[model samples]
Target: MRPIGLLTAAALSFLTSVALAAEGKEGMPQLDFKNVLLKSQIVWLVIIFVVLYILLSRWALPKVGAVLEKRAATIAGDLDAARQAKGAADAAVAELTAKTREAHAGAQAEIAGAVDAAKAAAAAQTATLTARLDAQLAEAEGRINAARAAAMGALRQVASDTAGVVVSRLTGVAANAAAVDAAVGSALSARGLG
Candidate 1:
């Protein structure tokens, strides 16, 4: 099949020349119905018009329509792709948000657990230290009591020796040991020291 565009271009050029010739011939010949060539010109006009219309409708117009349809389909495909991409991006963003929240929660849980463990360890250490200090205090108190007992025993011996010397010097005779010890014991008991 011949290209309709080329045929149409040729037809337009021929029609322009015919129109110019008709003007040169003093008037529009195609409109003059009384002329011998008027019938032939009208028949030729009808034939050209029908042929042009058929060529445009069957070949040229269908090709243009197909091109338009193809362009529309391409645009639709691009739009669909863009929408799908947007959906995927949205899903990815939501997933990332969820994961971030989960991770944050997990970290918080870990921190709480660590704090609890640290608190437990501190309590255990405190208990152990308190027990150790209490034991040391008891041992120190026992030592102090023992020292006090030893000092008191030594004080009694010293007092007895001093009493003997004082008695000999005052009476000019040796004091009896049993009588001196009895006097010291009575003196200590009266003073609430025995």
Candidate 2:
């Protein structure tokens, strides 16, 4: 017998002794030692306890243990899946970060290239404008010099005419055109006007 059977037997013996002591004295028929059915009741109680324990050990307890084991396995599987997902997520995040940095660098390079191109275009335009302006300025200077030369030639002719008119009026004789021109030329050369 198991420990539980020993205990049940000991309990049953003590109850029987008590019932015998209180047999004819106690008014409770349930405890009466003269009642032979009490022994059969004790035997039935022991049989019921043993059968119930066997049923629980063979069927119910094993089912409960299987359920617990399945639950533990499921929890472990879920944890492993979560860890794998976290690792994949971390790798994706790292890749995204690297791509982001690469895209930023590419954008920066493109921006710098655009800036350089713009600056070069502007410089070229400035040089072209400068050259055009210089040409225009030089043309203007040449026009001014031409106009001054023409004006000076007209002034020399007028001076010669005036000198011839003065010479004819003072000497009462017609002045020579060749002599007037030579005199004006000499005067103009001396004054640095020729």
Candidate 3:
């Protein structure tokens, strides 16, 4: 397959060359350097080449260079701006993290202070309540002692009066000094107050 393709290409190339030669413009006018040397085709071709080179160097090359420099500068500026933006973002993140840490510390400190204050307040309240309860208990005890003393005195007086009445009835006589004395003595002895 490859050999056939190569043979076909060679045949086509040979045919194209023969056709071009048959149609060649061979009778064109020739420039004679002996009469007009500077106006020759070779001289004109050199002039055109020089003019194109001058125009490209003076106008086209500078414009192209300026455009490339401007593009390069714009690219560099964009990269620098991107770098600055990234740095700013990093700084902002650091600042935010620092602020968060500070806030956490402040909150923890405040919570600790509040807890301490609450504990102190509770302790003070507990002390006050204990003191108040103690005072109340003491007062209650004093009142109970006074009531018991009064009740005992009243019972003793009632017993003495009853004994006097009984003695008078058993003796079948009026109330006398001896009977009274005996009754008082008996009452005192019964109450262990003698």
By TM-score, who's the top model here? 1
Any residue pairs clashing in model 2, and if so which? none
Clashes of 1: 0
Ranked by lDDT, the better of candidates 1 and 3 is 1
Against the true structure, what is each candidate's TM-score? 0.47, 0.45, 0.43
Q: Residue-wise lDDT of candidate 2 within 1-194, one digit each (tens)?
A: 69999999978977876786677445447657777798888999999999999999999999999999999999999999999999999999999999999999999999999999999999999999999999999999999999999999999999999999999999989999999999999999999998
lDDT of 3 by residue, 13-115 (tens): 7687667668983321342345565367678999999999999999999999999999999999999999999999999999999999999999999999999
lDDT of each: 0.89, 0.93, 0.82
lDDT of 1 by residue, 1-194 (tens): 46798899878867886888778853455557788787887799999999999999999999999999999999999999999999999999999999999999999999999999999999999999999999999999999988977876787778888999999999989999999988988887788776
The TM-score between candidate 3 and the true structure equals 0.43
Model 2 earns a TM-score of 0.45
lDDT of 1: 0.89
Worst 10 residues of 1 by lDDT: 24-33
Full ranking by TM-score: 1, 2, 3
Clashing residue pairs in candidate 3, if any?
none
lDDT for 54 (candidate 3): 100
Clashes of 3: 0
* CA lDDT, candidate 1, residue 84: 100
